[model samples]
Target: MGISTKEGLDIDLYQNKGRFLYKYAGSFLENAVKICFKSRFPESGSKRIENSSGVRPRMFEIDCLVGNDAIEIKWRDATTDGDHIIKEHTRLKSIASSGYKPIRIMFYYPNRSQAKKIQLALSDLYAGLGGEYYSGEAAWTYTEMRTGIDLLSILNRIANERGVS
Candidate 1:
């Protein structure tokens, strides 16, 4: 089962001039994954962990927790920077080492070919953590809470609705 929301998700909520849009994009990805969780694990007691609004340097929050699993959804595009990538890798490694089942969902545009190259470049960052890299086509399975939900389609729908080309 896949999540279906009635209202349109607005990417414009995070649109700003000359900004990386990390927070906004993170929020959007969290919400999207939460929707998938709700539908897929309706009885698993899974939910998106909420945090207080406002910018704080040390704020800690996991994207979603399902049956003792810590899942994070990342929307990686061509504009993604090295610093943010390293930060996320460190977080995932820490979470896994702490005994949580760390699952990372990496969303990329265009196709798996390009996404694979990007994934390979990040291997060193996640090295020694048994991190497995999958192409975009196979990424959904690793990050999915349940089968049959097309996450890429949901992303495309959001992009289309937001007129993001």
Candidate 2:
């Protein structure tokens, strides 16, 4: 094959595989966190609330809602798009207006400066709206404290058993 054609093929393959890996990993981690929360708070699970603001979607999803708390769980969020801030702001506002305290818990923190900035903005937004944001080690600690489950330790044990590291 020609050089350009080979390069294009390689890029396409990489993009497809990357998308699958990211989606699968994120879904798995988010579901695991929800499971932990459900074990502790039997009533907690995914929830959908009206956007009250008449947003385009007209609805926003809370990954897990326990009592009055609206939680958004993520394995990692590395989006550098400025639009993300606007969307998240709207979502949080809708949650708040619906009488729920918005919360965000992300296991991994983005390393890129732009992505870091986005996360910082989100953290501030959460605080400004009377919500909470936790990422990295703090996220792990928060999950364990709230669920009475040492998630990291359990994951480590599983990894060791599978000889992953």
Candidate 3:
């Protein structure tokens, strides 16, 4: 499993405004995913969250932890940002392989089309990643969203594709 924590998690962004921005976006998405996860799998534990008092990783700290799950979230804003997704995916896989119950490597691009470009480009980054043909009535809600979606399903889909889950 990932590092056992006495509390939930601790994020330590380096910039001054970065901290505020991180919390704003992070809180939004966390709520969104928590609802989705509970609706689909009520038995699954809901996310338990915590933050660091100050910035600190020291090369040995988690960014965010949800229950027994550990996650590291990042954003990419550039003409070409494929590498960012690859790096995050690899890191999460490594953590999972090491025995973490659920390792989430979430990457999303925001207000920049609210995630349209990111969703369109998701296949480009995850070449072998499979899809579930999201044809639900509320498909459009997640089409260009950065804060809503089921992380477990996404990870399970990808993990099953790579023979991980």
Candidate 4:
């Protein structure tokens, strides 16, 4: 008998094609946030830096930076890995240390009955992570949304009052 690389599997186990949806989902969310803020207030100064190829690696390049606020938009699939947790830890630390407010907006793909429960879960996770990573005042808010459209009014208000704080 000859050696078989495929073994008993009918499909290739290792492939990079599956990640495109995640990438697209992230871009879609970023654009949706940007559009929402811009449409509501024309001079909100909201910009999309998600796909920006900066001169150097950004230590904490959030999705949208308006005024003194750093907004991070996440498109989650009901699962968070270690790397994601660590990255958020560092990102929030960087934002706070840089004297900017850190605002996290998470969009969960899976629908659940109690949105409050999901929000509380995320808030608890961030609370622990923020406590360990950030030393300064944690004056940030963790918002969980079932859909990107839910962020329109909230983001608009944040962007509009960016300079106030």
Clashing residue pairs in all predictions, respectively, total 0, 0, 0, 0
Higher-ranked by lDDT: 3 or 4: 4
Q: What are the per-residue Cα lDDT tens digits for candidate 1 across 8-61?
A: 223333345215455676567657767777677775443433223223323445
lDDT of each: 0.56, 0.91, 0.42, 0.49
Order the candidates by lDDT, highest first: 2, 1, 4, 3
| TM-scores for every candidate against the unseen true structure | 0.51, 0.89, 0.32, 0.47
Query: Cα miss at 53, model 2 (Å)?
Result: 2.5
Q: In model 4, where do residues sit more than 4 Å from their true spots?
A: 1-20, 41-58, 77-80, 109-122, 125-165
Error of 1 at 86 (Å): 4.1
Off by over 4 Å in 1: 1-30, 43-59, 77-82, 109-118, 124-127, 132-135, 143-147, 152-165
- Per the 3 Å backbone cut-off, how many clashing residue pairs does candidate 2 have? 0
Regions of candidate 3 where Cα sits further than 4 Å from its true position: 1-21, 45-83, 89-121, 132-165
> Which wins on lDDT, candidate 2 or candidate 4?
2
Clashing pairs in 1: none
| Residue 18 of model 3, lDDT score | 63
Candidate 4 lDDT, tens digit per residue, 3-88?
37675242344233445646774677567756665565455543423222222236445555656666655554344445544454
Candidate 3 per-residue C-alpha lDDT over 1-165 given as tens digits, one digit per residue, 9 for 90 to 100:
574453324323235356665776556555545555445545544333222221222122334444444433333232336655444345433444444433323444444563546544543433333222121223223422423564546656877999974
Cα deviation at 113, candidate 1, in Å, is 13
Ranked candidates (TM-score, high to low): 2, 1, 4, 3
